[model samples]
Each structure stands twice: as structure tokens, then as C-alpha cells.
Target chain A: MVVGLAAGFAPAAVADAYLDMIEAETEKIAGPLPTVVDGEAGAESEEDAGFQEFLAYLKEESLGSYTFFEKLTPAQRSEVFERHKQGASLEQIREIIMERFLKR
Target chain B: MRNCVGMILGLACLMQPVWAEEVKVGEADSEFAVKLTEDTDYLHVVHQGKSVKVQRVQDPNYELRGYFAKTGRKCPPFCLQPMHADPAVTSVGEVEVLEFMENELRDGQGFLIDARTPSWFQKGTIPGSINMPFTVLSKGEDDPEMAAALEQFGAKRRGPVGAMTKTLEGWGLFEAEQKTAAWDFTEAKQLLLWCNGPACGQSPRAVRGLLEVGYPADKLFYYRGGMQIWQLFGLTTVIPDA
Candidate 1:
């Protein structure tokens, strides 16, 4: 009776069975995903905060510089941040931004 | 009898060449001898709310310097482009460009596009050209910025496609030359595009991009001798404000 019932549902049952087996195998090979920690989340937020602070500095120090700064690509913005970290003056940073803006 | 004679003399004077006293450009003996053509001394075009006079540098000793004057650049990126961007598009020279400025551009029937990036544009560009970067155009029609640019060029987006419209478009029934699946370009402006020089690929890329988006080839013009040749000939360039 059981074999007859299995034969009756053969195609779909076999496909589902194969899919389940593949999923099980994949899960076995790939262990549980790593969990995100509060510290990592906090660090990401801190980075955002730092970028905001840099933007605020740009907006405050220079009158029309922020308009040009907004046009910089992500890589350029990163370079600007790096330069700022190295204690480059606002004029130096603006020049670097303008040069990049002009080139790209 | 005297009145009749005077009238005949006045008519003869009126019929005589009015341009006889007018100093033509490139004439044999003139202090400022440099000229664009036999007739054209200069061009007037409004740039950034100011009327700019576009003319060749009158100083006989003036020479081009700086980036455009450089002879060689790496070939992979700066490989010399062909005269025609596409078979259907017309390749034009300085005279044609000047004519275009006087006719189509002046009449608002066309646009002269500087296809280089904004950075290059900021340094300097040909008079009466607006910068439209190849990067922006090459982003594909579906991109919002690209779509906006297409709209600016007078391409209109079609509404949602129905089955009947698709079927007609698929068949030969619909007018397809100026129509794409997504856009209608019947009202698009005639565009003359230029870049750094014949060695530059920016304008060609822009042309290709527009073609891909179903811009009419007949409406496109390629100025192969771009800023480099323009400068080599001592033509005018204007630095755009940031």
C-alpha cells in the first residue's frame, strides 16, 4: 500500500525530496551565519557621525565650498576625509577637491 | 532735367555694392588681418547671461599653450577617432560649426554639446557649448539622470505600453524611426557634439549612447576636431563658472 502511494506521487515528491536534500547539504557545508554585535553597530554609527561632523566643518568654514564638495565622488570624499585626518588645511583640502572635481 | 539726372544718379549709387567699404575678414591689407572666413569676422553668442564675442586671436604672434597644445597622449584611451561618428551622422569642420552657431544654435533649433566631463568643462570650453558628459549619457536610458537628460534634449517618455501598442510597434505599422519602446524623439533638438579632439572618444561614446536610446542619426553632428584643433587654430574658449 505504501509503495503504491509513493508511486502515485512520484514526480513532484522526488523533485521536492531532491530540493530538500540539496538544502540540507548546503546548510551542512555552510554553518550558521555570524551575528552582528552591538559594538560593530556602534562603530558604524560613529563613522556616520564623524562624516556628518566633517560635512558640518566644511559647511561652516567655507562659504561656497560645500557646494563643490557635494559634487565629489565617494572615493574623492574618502580622500578628503583622509586628508582632513592628516591635518591638511581647509584651503589645501578645497584645492584637492577642486582638482579631483575638474579631472573627473 | 537736373532733377531727373539726380534721381538716376541716386539709383545708380543705391545699386552699387554697399559692402565695398565694409572691411571683410582675411582681406589682403588690414591691421587685424586674422579672420575666420572671407565674410565672418566674429560670432556673437550669449554665455552665462553675457554676450560673448567669439573670434580668432588677432595677435599674429599668439600661440596655444597648456594642456590642449600637448601632441601625444596614451593611445588606449586617447586613440584617434574616425571622421564620422556614425554613417548617418554628418562630420563637420569649423566653418560648418560657425554656420551652425549662426543659424541653428542662434535660432534655438540646435544645441552644441561639450561631451567631456565637467572638470574639463570648468577649465575651458568652446563658445556656445553646454557640457553634457559622456559618462552621464552612457548610464543607459533607464537611469533617472539619463532619462532627465533625454527629456532635456526633447525626448518624451511613452506611457505604459498596452498589448495593441506593442503589437503595432512590433509590426511595421507604427512610425519607428523617431520612436523607441520607451521614448518619442520627434521633437528632439539637433545636437552637435565635440570633445577633446579627434583622439578623444568622449563625443563618440556620447553619440553611441544617444543612438542606443534611439536618437535620430540625421539630427546628430560630430565635430571631430574638438578643443585641441580649435585651440590649434587660435579659436576662442571660455572658462565656465563653478
Candidate 2:
């Protein structure tokens, strides 16, 4: 089931680098969360209070222009929440965003 | 032995043969500048990803018809004028508008104003335009300088909050302000506001801003053909406050 979904939403080469960085940054904040459920779960929840703090700092610096939730599509946003529950790899989730939202 | 053989066979895989070719962004004929037929109300965007089928319920403004997995239209051609649920504005021809400009400017039909940032204004502007940056409108109400400027323009200050916020946010901020502010007719008969054209919406935003500030719609005309149009016509423009 996961592979089928991933196949549909594969990121392009150009966008994958940024996705990887976002994944790492989110993980560094979230700490040893579940890898299987990476995407939004690792990025959104307070599981990584430190990362949330970091995001707040970035948001403030950018004058609230950088919106994480708004940036992602409905499908990608929900996947992030699911990744948190599954403790998936941040990489996997980021891939979904690149493939599903930005690439298209 | 049979199960072991099957497992071994499953592990073996081969790369699938496929053609590698670079996909183009837009259709050839569609990209060219053409006078769109009035009867033609729809433009189909055929692309690899979500195919955007946009129907022109109104000129310039398109409505998304569907997003098909295969041959579905995700967005319309050239990212043109924004697709609005209510398309108040219409598209204009790049070529045919030359006479309109000469007539309007010659007859004093309108005043041209460049409402970009001071820095952008300094770079270049439409010939015979005064630079009144839109930043003044975006500033806080308590900003004494902006308040004073607004007063000079004869704008009413009803609320303590920034006066232009209602106008600004309504028109999608940056693009709307540029479009609406171009309509300020303090000194002229009609206002032509422009930043970039077609792909850019700053001028449209400014125009919408002016409309919010109680400017008459008839007195307002957006040069959808902005600086790009000016530059293309071999017409010279002044650089910034020059």
C-alpha cells in the first residue's frame, strides 16, 4: 500500500535536494521519532518542540510569509500527519511533497 | 525446492525499456500572441502532470474545469491574468493597444503612475509617470509620513488601523496594490497602473486597491500591457525619479 502511494508521488531530481534538507531539519528537531511515519508527523506535531520553536523563529524572521501548512497540498498535508503516527522517515514524507505538489 | 526456486526468480528483476525525451512547457500555437476569437471560451492545457482545463467564462480570468490524471488541465496558458471565481477584469491585446496609449496620453485621457518600490521606480518607469510607491499604503496607520501623504491625496482616514489594509488584503496584497494604485486620478482623468505585464499581478493588485478607495471603475483603465508592452513598442521610458 505504501509503495503504491509512493510510486504515484515520486519527487523530481531538482526538488529532492530541498526536500531532503527539510526532512533533516524537521528530524533534528523532532528527535528519535518513528522512521516509518516520517512526513508531516515529524514536521507538524510538538513531538519535536525544539523544531516547532525553530519553525516559529523562521516564520517570524520571514514576516509570516513562510507557511508550512499552506505550502503543502491537502494530500501531502494529511500524509505528514499520518507519518507522525507511523513514525516514518522524514525523507519518505518529503518525497511525497516534491512529487505530489511542487513537481506538478 | 519449488518455493525456493520461486523466491529466487522473484528477486531477479530487469530495467524496463522506455523512451527518454524532454517535455515542453506549453503548446506551440497557444504560446504565440494571437487575437483570441470571442467565441473561443476555453483553453485546454495539455501537460504531463495534473492536466489543467481552464474555461474562459470571462476574458483573461479563467475557471478551472477539471484536474485529470491523464490529459487533465491543471492551469491555463502562460499563467496569464489570475483565475478568479469572479473575473472582474478582462484581457487586452498587446499589439492593438498602441493607438489607445497614444490617444489616451495625447488627449490627457489618463495619468500613468508607477507604484512599485522606490528602488524599482528608480530603475525605470513608464514615460511621464510620477513615482508614488505603494509601500506608503501598506505602512501602519500611525506612520506619520504615510498618514501625511494620504492626507495630501485627499484620502479619508476613518479607522486608526492602516487605511489601505482593507483594500490591500482584498486584492491579494502585492499584485492588487500595484493594479489599484495605478487608478489614482488625483491629477489626471484616468489612471494607468502597471508593473510587469501578463505574468505579473502587482499592477492588478494596485488597481483593485484604487477601486476599494472609492475610485470610479469607468475612470480606471489597467494597462494589462505594462512596462513589457512599453518596452516592446520601441518607446523610451524615464529611469526612476528622472
Candidate 3:
């Protein structure tokens, strides 16, 4: 009877041991889970919000040139916003962006 | 009063021919009158919210000049492209393009795409054609710009696909020709894409890039002759803002 009980328990114990070994191997391979700091996450979201606002402004005021402006790199887009802040009209911004593309 | 009368007579004489000499397509008195075809007199399309009449120069002496008129270009980049970008993508000529403008384009069922870079496109493009640069289209579907372009071309994102769905697609149980893992092109617009000319690779590359992303082959048409041939035949071109 003792041998019979031992046999059933032995398979269950072996299975648990195999599972434990697999979990350990997987953890070793994957390393630590990345922790997202609150500050970094907040900064990314803030930048995204700013970009979305700029896109909305472009869509509303410069619908004709919006597609071209949307293709600008982040740096280029910043320059365009700076120009706008400095009193450049949408048409002037478009021409400036177009000149840059034409030079390319 | 005598001097005023004489001035009025001179002005009338100048205006007479201006009103009388207005020549309609296929009705020019000169033997050099140009016609698109025996049936087609001219094509009319809308460009930048204005109606544009596309017709050849009536002057028999008119010659193609400037960049398009050149016979040769450096080979490596400007080498002639094949008749077909892909076997499945139909190649079209000027007549078919005109017909497309009259029917599909006018009906909003198709798009005439100028697939050159902005530098080339800004110079001028075929009337009624909108610029969708090859660079933008060839960036792969995963790119945000490319995804936006695909959306503009009437493709919808399918989001992520499950393994079971993928297996069904692989087994031909799903309609796969108009779909990719990323995009559903079931309602994609018919695109007639052109670039510089027969030697231009821009449109062909754009077509191939679209095909790689599983855009329906039937929806893509390549105009291999492009701007060069379009000009050789004296079709109309329009500068975007000019």
C-alpha cells in the first residue's frame, strides 16, 4: 500500500519539479521585467499631446498644404511651428516647407 | 468727334478677329489642327477645384522642349522599365488614361496618381493627377505615413490577426487577395500611377511596394509611358499652384 501511494505521489512531484525548472529557465532567459517610471511616461504622453495639437491646427488652417506638412520630420515641424509663432502665415509656412522639399 | 470715331473703328477691327478666330478642337481651319482621337476632341477634368481643359497645342510647329523632350538620360536610374510592373498589374496607355478620366475618375471610382518625388511633381504633373510620392508609398505598410497613405487609397486596417485566422487565410478558406495581415484592401480605389516616363522607376517601385502589402493587383494600373510619353503626345500638364 505504501509503495502504491509512493508511485502516485512520485509522478505528481516529478511533474511539479519539471514545471518549476521550466519557469526558472524562462525567467533566466527573459531577465527582469522593465519598470516604466512615472516621469518618463508622462513626458512621452506630453510630447504626443503637443504633436496632436499641432496636427489639428494644420488640418484646420492649412488643409491644402496639410499633407505636405504632415510629411515633415519632427525637427522640421518644430521649425514650422517656430515660424508660425514668429508671425509667418500658413501660406508662407507652406512655401518654406516646399522650398525645403524642392531642395531635397 | 472725328478722332474718337477713328479710334473706335481701330478697336473694333482688333476685336473682330479675336471673336471670330476662336478655334474649337477638331474644328480648326488649319491642316495642323490637333485632335486627341477621331472620337475624342479633348478631355476635361478638375484640377485644384477648377475645371481644366486638357488638349494639345494647336500650333503645328509646336515642339516638345525642356526636360521631357530629351531622348536620353543616364542609364542606371533612368533605364527603361518593363511593360508590366507586375504580371497582375495592368499596363495602360494614353487612351485608357483618358477614358479613366472620363469615367472612373469623374465618377470618383479611381485615382490618377503622380508617383514622383515632390521636386519632380512640383514642376508639373498630368492634369487631374494628384501627387502621391513613390517615397511615401514605398516605405512599407508598417510606417505611419505609408499607413495613412493606404488609408487615403481606401484601405482599412485589420488590426492584429489571430493565429487561427492566419491559418484559415493560409489554407485559402479566407478571401486573401484583397487582404494582408495589416490591411484590408477590399474597397481600395483603382490607382493609375505614373512617373517621369518609360525610363522612370518611381511608379513601378510604388506599385511593387503596394503589392508587397497585398493591395489587390487588379486595383493597380501602371502608366509606363508616364510624363515623357504624355508630353510627346502633347497631353496637358499643370503646375500645382501655378
Candidate 4:
């Protein structure tokens, strides 16, 4: 029974080792794992150029500017990125970010 | 003749300057410059018994092009973090970081962490820093990899999970009984974390993850001006051997 179990587990262990090695090499060139679970929701948002432009504008707004981006979770932020990519203007995206994310 | 020679040596010693040479960083009036333990070509450090030379490469074959060269990025994901990661966290500059590299890291009192992914780390990184990608520790609470890492960091768990308490472990204390029971925060090693500078959030994310895992705020330091700023001033970076 012991020998049978050991033999059965060998393949899985070997598979895991290979996976580890492959991942190590890939990461050495590519980047870290892009997991939504790296943090909370909004971290995985897509690069919506319009929404991003609005954020850049906000950052330039000198007096007491808020960190509106971090207000939403990664998933919500992804939705915003998606919306901007569709057809929304900077104004419309700003309105949406404020409505959903900004504290009342 | 011997007595006269001794008197002459004593006079020479008295005339010598009391203060060591002052070190000034690149920027003109920004505060934090430091004096080092005499000028040398390399920063020598011992990690796990192997001596590692942390020195600036006189000339590297590569150049900073493409992504790192690009000045701007879409804001939401590639946003600029505040000078401070959190209210309590400390934000430091290259000068302070260099001092840490020369002193604290050399003595093994602290870890100057490069929170970038292996890709970025492999390209080039500050001398005396070790790569510990932020995502690794940001894994789910029950992640075996995270647990393994935390354990290797000398942190032992106590009590329950959510409502649990953990302490930083070290060698035996003054009391024999005090040696084992709980996680010892006092013995926890200092961590200096950084990423691609102010524009990058990777290091901040790692800071947050560490805080969430109950690492002491005081023990965590953010080198806000990371690689971009490091390269801006043309500070040294060492490429690790594959």
C-alpha cells in the first residue's frame, strides 16, 4: 500500500516541480502573477484611455484632490475601464466614477 | 630619540580632523546626505554565509529603453502613490536607502526589499536589495506559498487565524522561559520596501499586504523614490548573476 501511494504521488510531485521551474523562468522575464486576488477588486481594471485621461486631469487639480481610483474595488475599476473603452467621454466617466465611488 | 618620536606622533594625532568626510547626494538642497565608512568600490554583505558583493557596475551593456523609459502611463492602474504609502509609514529617498544599503543591510539588521516582479528585478535593481515580489505575500490568506514564506521569515502563528496573534521569532532571550511561547515582535527584522518609484504601486501594495498580515507599521519603510528616481540620479544598480 505504501509503495503504491508513493508511486501515485510521484507524478504529481514531479508535475508540481516542473510547474515551479517554468513559472520561475517565465516570471524572471515577464512579471509577477496578475491576480485580481493580489489585493482587492479595482486592481485588475483594464486600461481605459478616457478614464485614465480623466484621472490624469484630476491629479493636476491642485487643491485637495481625492484618490478617486482607489475608491472602487478592482472589479468596479475594470468596469469603468470597459465603459471608457466603449464610447464614454471624460465627463461621463468622471460622473460615473463620482456617482459610484465618491463618498456622499 | 624614541621619546621625541612618540611626542611628535601625539602632536600629529591632535592636529587630525575630528569629523569624517561628508557625503552629498545628487540633488542640491534636499536634506538627506550621509557619510559612509570610508569610500570603497563595493558594499560587502553576507547572506546565509555566502559573501555577496553589492557594487555598482562601472559600465553595463544594457540601456533603459521601452517601458521604463516611457514617462507616463494610464493613471488608474499605473497611478502615482502619495509620498507616504500610509499615514504611519515612512517615506525615504535614495540617500537614506544608500545608507541602509551600506550599513543596516551590511550588518544584517534589515532587508532592503525590491518589490518588483522577477522580470524587472532581473533587468536591474539597487545594490544590496533582494527581490520579494509583492504578489507572493499578497496571496490569499490560506495560500500555502504565503504560509511557507511567513514561516521562513521566522514568524510563528499563535491562537486562531482571524483572531490570531503572531510574533517575530529570534534566538533565545535573556530568560529561558521567554524563548518559545509567542511570536516576538521585538526581534522582527526591519524591512525597506521599494518598487518602480512614485509612479509604481507595486511596493505600496506589498506594504499594504504586510500591514494586513499584522507586520508592525514602524518596522515597514517605503523607499518612495524607487528605480525611476534611482536611475534619475544615476545611482548604482547591480545585475544578479543567473
Candidate 5:
């Protein structure tokens, strides 16, 4: 489903760059995160204000990457956060997020 | 006569293990002095002028059926949940649930939620639990029930409790916040939620939906054992008047 959305704007190659940019920028805020345990990122960040900082980046970041976040409902976005909390990587988050919003 | 006395003492000693007294712990301040917690464990809840005990039922005749007995559910929809719904969320057993009831429910600082439908809830439920079906959180694409439930659970909207926001892609979400949404943690209440059991996706789904809507995992407690385990422990359940 997200692949279809990826096709709408940037080609698969461009979406890859966008995904990479989002990951690199995210790692800058909270170091390199595991793809599977990314849910821990959301899990640990509830009390930490730092998670909010990273979340704001997803909301305001101009890149096409994570822009699909805008299309997602709070519940859907939370699914992305939960995946990260559960150990999903940034790329995995993007894939998961795409699958969530684009498919629906 | 001395040997006869010794023989009687030996017989009494042999019977000790067979008829031991049930040890009770914790203090309940109501009418009766009920020991709710383990002797060293110490768990109790205060209500009105009485410190009521939160405990499992001691009845030996309790049995499980219906929702608690349904074990053949499908995943992707009815999957077995991980102990932690999220990184911060804690999976609670009957003891912690009772503790939460004493601490949060008593003071009105929290909720003991039964994540079952009204029909099931009407049949019977834990002493202090309220009904909230998972479908409320998982209904249609534009779920108004979920939005209201979130607000009722003490989650204030990023804008107004139910305001709409534009997704980056330009598809509008009715009340689903994406960019500017934030859950006000200060005003939020602690929630202890449960459904039929681990296999019952109702509570887990509701919790995940709440998490999806930015409910803090810590403020949310999953009673993974739910009614199935609750019944297994012979906990008290009352039929809702409704």
C-alpha cells in the first residue's frame, strides 16, 4: 500500500533516500535504534522529553520521508511509535507506517 | 498414662499438615477484619469508614465458561499478546489489579476497565470494573466512539479533545491528530484495563488503539489475565444491574 504512495510522488529510489534521511536524522536525536525493538524507543520516551523532540521532527520535518505520518490517524501514528517501541527500525517504521496508512 | 499421652501428641503432630489454618495477610478496614494481602505482603483498600479487602474469592466451586472459555481465536485480529503492550506498559496480574483498585479506584484517581462489550459486561464483571468494548477503539475508519472514549479516559486532545487535523498528504483525519497532537499527561488518569483473557483481543486491541492515539503506555496497565484468569483464581464477580 505504501509502495503505491511511494509511486505517487517520488519513485522507489527517491522514497529510499527519504527513508534514509528520516533514519539518519532520527539517529541524531536518539542514536542508532534497533529495527525490532523500536517500540522500546516509544516505551522509554514516555517520561523523557527527548521522545517529544524526535516526534516533532516527524511532524515538522520537510522531507517526503515520514510525511506519510500526516496521513495517519493518531492511532495509526501510535502504531508506528509502538513498533519503534517494540524494536522496529526507522526503515521498518516507514514500511510499517506506509502499510498502515496507505493500505487503509 | 505418660506413654498414652505421648501417643496422643504424636497423632496430633501427624494430623497438623492435613488441617492447617488458612493464613491471611493485609488489613481491610470494613465491618469484618479481612486479610486481603499475604501476611508479609500487606495490600488493602480503604472505602468510606472501612478499609475493604481486595482479594481473590476463596470459593472452591467457581468454574469458567463462555467468553473465558473461548480459546479458538484467529491472529492478525485475535493474536496472543506480548506481556508488554508497549515498552512502558506493564502487564499486571490479579494482585496488582487489586492493588490498583485500592489505590486508584478508591481515590477516583484511576479506572478498573472491563474491555468487553455491554452484553458480556451485563452478565458479570470484576467488582470495580467498567465496560468499554475494544470495538469502540477499533470501529470504522472514522471512529467517533474512540475519540470520545479517549477524552473520557482523561486524554485531552492536542487541540480541543476532539479536533481534526490535516495529514501531511492532505487527506484529513476527522479527529486523528498527526502533526500537532499531544496527550496531556498531567490531567490523565491511571487506567487498569482487561478483557476476557490473554487470547481475548478486546482489551489488548483497545490498549493498542489507545497507544496508537498517543495514550502513554505507562499510564495504561494491561491485566493480561483478565476474566479467564480471574475466574481461575476464584475472584469475585458481580452481575451488572444494567
Candidate 6:
């Protein structure tokens, strides 16, 4: 499945370049967490917001075909891993494309 | 408004497919569109009709529960609870374990459930426990065995509650046999629901389902340490004949 996704998103030769772009962008936002929301748990606000931004980029960039982390620019992969570590919802991330992410 | 228009356009742009990939996780009906991340532990399982995202922590041994925590965002906000809303079954000490043993397979205390598929039940199950699969309990009269079982339980073709009870009763699943599984809290006493063991949550869900059906909650107990505990203690188990 991973290989299939990689091929569809970026031919093997250019996949590396595509991944590099994602990684760079991911690193930029991850470096600085968003402002903490009042009455919210510590770090969650910033963490969630950062993740949302990264998700938006992935969605707008048409990342549905990307395979594992290899399809992402190194920066993009970093952002995803970073957000996941902070416990972002994978469902919300998927909603960026499938358009079926239920808010309930 | 331009903003609304832009928003719609933005969403449309996002929907454009970069590539299509097939990713199947667990027993889901179909593959889901996914973008994997290193920190995430599961894969998305999607059936175009509906999708349930799962985390594949134990790849070869993955079950839907492991991904429950990941799919919280898709559920109604009210349903989301802290991951550790309830203490781990293993962590609850003996004291906290109000009742941990079953007496007669029929009268046991804690819980003695059969967690396997009902097909497995046709093969056999411990004397007590009602069949409640962790994945999904096949509902509707469409299921012949389930239908026949509920019929035996005196399940009149009423509604959801009646059908659910019939299913349980048909399987002979009651904390203390129908004569005892009553609403009168005093009658409930210490009852447990089980299907398999610590790894299975069917019993817990069954207990919760019962509570929703208006069963007394306090008297209700969850033998989280299910079949595992039963087997460890060297209790009796029965196999059903086809």
C-alpha cells in the first residue's frame, strides 16, 4: 500500500524532493507552538493549532496519495510525526481530504 | 459572501486526489484515503459508505479497540472520555475488585463470558456468559441463530431494547439467570459480563448497554479481568454442541 501511494503521488525519482518540501514547511510551524488558550489544558491548544495548520497544508497540497512518511517532504513528515506525538486526532487529519471527518 | 465562496473553493481544492491507494486495516469493509505519520500507530480503514479510522499498534494482531483512542475526533464530543476514563482491568486491586469469582457457572460472582464469535459458541462456551463480540454483534432478525436465540429468551419482536434483551437471554446471558437479572437493585447483587478477557471490552460494553437499557448501574459490575481471570483461577468452562 505504501509503495502504491508513493508512486501515485510522486514518481520514485521526484518523491524525495516532494518529501523535502513537506519537511521544511512542517519544521517551520512546529518550532513555535501556538498561543495557549485560556482555561485549556497546558500545551494542548498550541499543539492542536499547529497540527491543524499542517493538516490544512497537506489537504490543499493534494497529499492523499502520499505513501507512509516517504511520500511527505521531510519537513511535512516531521510536522505530522510531531503533531501525532502530541496526540492529534488522526480522524481530523483525514477529514482534510475525505471530507467525512465528523465533528460530533 | 466571498469568504464562504472561498471556503467552499478551499474545501473543493483539498478534495482533489493526488493519488489513490488501497489500505485495509482489520475487518473493515474497504480501504481509506490516508496520509501516514510516524507518531501515529494505526492505518485508516474505509468503506466508501462509511469509514472508521484505526491505529494498527499490533499490526499482525490488530483489533479495533487499539484504534478507539484515535477515532475520538469522529465521535460526538459528548462521547469522548479521557483515554483512561476507567482504570485498566489489570490495575484494579483485589479490594477494588468487589467480586472476582463466579460460583456456579450459573451462579459465579465476578464474570464468566464467552468472547469468541457466536459460530465459536456453537462449538462451546463456559456455562454462563452471553455471546457479545468485541468487533460487532450482528443485529437484526436477519441473523438466524441470533433470531432463534432471542426467541428463546422471550424477546417479543418489540424494539431495540426488547431485541437486545432477547439476544442476551437467548444466549442464556444473565448475571443470575432470567429469574435473577432484574431491575430491582436488591435483586441484581454482584453481576458480571464477560467475553474472553482483559483484551476484550465486549463485557464492559455489554454492561454499559445493560445500564442504558435501564438496568441498575450500582449493582452492575464489570469483570474486566474476564475469561483470563476465570481460566487463571481454574474455574469450570463448558463447550456448546452444534
Give the fraction of reference interface contacts each candidate recovers. 0.00, 0.00, 0.00, 0.00, 0.00, 0.00
State which candidate has the highest TM-score. 1
Give interface RMSD (Å), model 3: 25.8
Q: Write the per-residue lDDT of candidate 2 for residues B14-70, one digit (tens) a residue.
A: 222233654543345443122223332222221111112222122223222211111
Pairs that collide in candidate 4 are: A41-A73, A41-A74, A41-A75, A42-A73, A42-A74, A43-A74, B167-B183, B167-B184, B168-B184, B197-B226
Model 4, B39-158: lDDT tens per residue?
Answer: 433333333223333333233343454345557765645678899887777888866786776566655567888887786776766656788887776664457776565555555654
- Minimum summed lDDT over a 10-residue window in model 4 chain B is located at B29-38
Better of 2 and 4 by TM-score: 4
TM-score of 3: 0.59
* Backbone collisions counted per model: 1, 37, 0, 10, 21, 23
lDDT of 5 by residue, B1-242 (tens): 22335777877676665334555433453322322444412222322222222345433343544444456554434467777666677888977887786567755678788887676565556766778776676543236787677678776655544322334314534423322244444467888889767766668767877777666666889998887777665554554444
10 residues in a row with least lDDT, candidate 1 chain B: B43-52
Most lDDT-accurate candidate? 1
Q: Write the per-residue lDDT of candidate 1 for residues B103-181, one digit (tens) a residue.
A: 7876668889999877666666787789898878777789998999888888899988789987887785667678888
lDDT per residue for candidate 6 within B10-107, as digits (tens), equals 79766766545544443343121221223333322111111222222233332332211122221221132222213422223212332232122212
Q: Assign candidate 2 its CAPRI class.
A: incorrect
DockQ-based CAPRI category assigned to the predicted complex of candidate 1? incorrect
Give i-RMS (Å) per prediction. 25.4, 24.1, 25.8, 19.0, 23.6, 26.8
TM-score of each predicted structure versus truth:
0.60, 0.33, 0.59, 0.49, 0.49, 0.27
Docking class of 3: incorrect
Model 3 is docked with a DockQ of 0.01
Looking at model 5, give its docking quality level. Answer: incorrect
Q: What is the RMSD of candidate 3?
A: 21.5
Model 1: which residue pairs collide?
A102-B119
lDDT of 4 by residue, A1-104 (tens): 99999999997796456335434533333332221011212222345346666456556752122367556545445545555545556677677567546422
- Name model 5 segments beyond 4 Å from true: A1-104, B1-36, B39-55, B60-79, B139-143, B158-183
The Cα error of candidate 3 at residue A16, in Å, is 57
Which segments of candidate 2 are over 4 A away from where they belong?
A1-104, B1-80, B83-109, B137-188
Q: Fraction of native contacts in model 5?
A: 0.00
Clashes of 2: 37
**Model 5's DockQ score:** 0.01
